[model samples]
Target: MDRALLNALFDEAVAKAQPELAVTRFLPAQPKGRTLVIGAGKASAQMAAALEKAWPGPIEGLVVTRYGYGQACERIEIVEAAHPVPDAAGLAAAKRIVDMVAGLSADDLVIALISGGGSSLLPAPADGLSFEDEQEINRQLLASGAPIGVMNLVRNQFSTIKGGRLAQAAYPAKVVTLVVSDVPGDDPALVASGPTLPLKGTRADARRFVELYRLDLPAAAIKLLASDENLAPQPDEAVFARNTSATIASAALSLEAAAALARQRGVESAILSDAIEGEAREVARVHAALAKEVAVRNRPFNKPVILLSGGETTVTLRGKGRGGRNGEFLLSLAIELDGVAGVTALAADTDGIDGSEDNAGAFVDGTSASRMRAAGIDPLAYLANNDAYTAFEAIGDLFVTGPTGTNVNDFRAILIR
Candidate 1:
């Protein structure tokens, strides 16, 4: 258990999966016509910069990202905005982007760079819906423990630019989208509410998600769903005929990069899955079991194996928790391991922000509990209140990598020796 080695491995993994590096390989050849770039997400600014450097022709556009994620790009205007929750800055930017792409000619090229956090950073309320109304709904959905897919389904219905409408607005223009997927399935349509991919979810799916979560919605939202006028953009629509989208990076890619680093250091690694989801604590328990199995039996995999997984997980906030989902998961996993020898693990969000917390995530080794107790922090009590961040902070185990400028969702790697 070399902590320095673990940290270096995590850093290398993130570097390999960064948008600037991952996006360049997926970029299509420069189109013959004018390239109009419009994007929104935590990584859009960096992705836009990468595009400008790689594209041979002139590229002109505007992209919105989280406040601290901006990069220098002369061709693409970068706007910083609030994230996780929509604000006036994001609302105004979304409107401007929508307007910027509308009424382009057939020869023009529209490249939409989308990634995580775009849902809130590119907030554009649908007709008959106010920004405040949409903001309120976003807050409720986030707190309701709804999965990203369900939340995006509801968001797409209420958004003016989402669900392929952005591409629709640029009708007759060739649209090419390069996405860094943060969703579980890596579905382009689900990422950033499918602003470029064709929207396939029906009003029924949106209604069911709301009902399933028992989320209270405004009357205007309910009315909009009941009416047939504001459905999500469909595949059969003319706008999708010339549109092309590619998932440039994903959580699995990050995990694999981490594994490669581990292997180079004489460590064996296995990717459990890239789409693991569910309650954060429950998912931790499952991972803990697998780790114990590998450590004890050495059956499915030999010792010194690292189990990797990615994808977004949720937390059904029941207490006054001051922790992100990754922290919660690590706390639960530490409890389950209970000082089991030769096991070290890290769980973090690829975007460098985990569930509104400042830290990227937390790390837990076999002695994690011992270290916390030595610092006079009660790990169990903190876990009960979902305050894993405080617990990890006391022991200096919290991983803080301020705004990596790209997002591919959560990355979890467990080392069993």
Candidate 2:
């Protein structure tokens, strides 16, 4: 398969999943009174822009996006902040959002645009808890190798706005939430920690995660989690009676788009699964094994077929690596493929940023392993140091797309010819 075409297919998947394509279709009807738009996430700004374009009436709102993920919006205000980590900007934005939604009458409408990466972009420390305390816990949770559900369970308990509190704050106003899912199973509560969704989890679960991971958190955070007061609102709460939510985009949709493109190109494609979750390197090894089987024995399918998958993957971050999970997966797959011919692969985060790095991800082909060795770049060493970014950069295979203004988790493709 042509490498450029393979990369192009990956790009197609991302483009298909963009908010501009999916958001307009899921928009709610215009409210009778003023429309107040509010949201947070990597894709939220783009989602807001889409809303403004589709809505015929005047829209007033505020949304927070990752530092580089903000898009142009005519009516709604866009706030840029940090992602994968909470910052003062996020805290201020979160506070402003809560204030904006307060004291609204029944005629007012609240449009919430939520997506992945919002957990960090919309952080608000609970009462009696400091922003520094929340930041510390966020740092620990990210490094704990916990799944998104578990991490969000803990994070929601510490936030003043997450776990349906955003919707609760907009009580009396008809709230319609539009989401772009980036979690396994497309569970609404796990996306961006479910800022506008109901709380299905309990404070007990949050405390359990802290103990399970042996997280060292501030005394105030621990105390809040242990207490029953100020807990997240349940589904039965009256605020939820007027709430409506829709998932506008997700991993499954993007994966199908990629598979469709492959079929159009006269290449067979099989989407293994869109709900996959696990360690990045281990997941890559499994994909590599399947690709080898297809290339050598042709058990899964005939040659010239591409294997595609999408979902969120975690890295334990044992070493001080400079790469994200996508880069790590590519590096591991390369080592496992061991210079096998007629095999090419690409792995990247759909959001156009992997982990905390600038590059979306990396690529690997038949000669990648041997070329790295010849260039004195050891894959194992880089992997051990969690530095796949440098290893792939040395081979000139780092895939950089800047900010795509969309997020649905990771996209991986393995081509066997």
Question: Each model's RMSD to truth, in Å?
Answer: 1.6, 1.3
Give the range of the ten consecutive residues with the poorest summed lDDT in model 2: 1-10
On lDDT, the candidate that comes out on top is 2
lDDT of prediction 2: 0.88
User: lDDT scores for all predictions?
Assistant: 0.86, 0.88
The 10-residue segment with the lowest total lDDT in model 1:
1-10
Q: Per-residue lDDT tens digits of candidate 1, residues 1-417? A: 556666776777678767778777877766767889999898899999998888888889999999889999998999999988899999889989988988788888999999988999988888898888899999888778888888888888888788888888898889999998898979888888878776677888888888989888888888898788677778888768878888888877777888888889898888888888898999999999989999899968998788889888988777786888899899999889877998888888888988888999988988898888889977788888888998999898899989887888888888887
Q: Which residue pairs collide in model 2, if any?
A: 321-386
- List, residue by residue over 1-417, the lDDT tens digit for candidate 2: 367867888788888878888988887787888899999999999998888999888889999999978889889999999988888899899999999999998988999999999999987988899889989989988888788898888888888898998888888899998889999899877899888897587788778888998888899987887899779888888779978888888899988988888898889899999988888989989999999999899977888899999888888878987989899899899999986989999899999999999999988987887778888889888888888998888889999989898899999999898
The TM-score between candidate 1 and the true structure equals 0.96
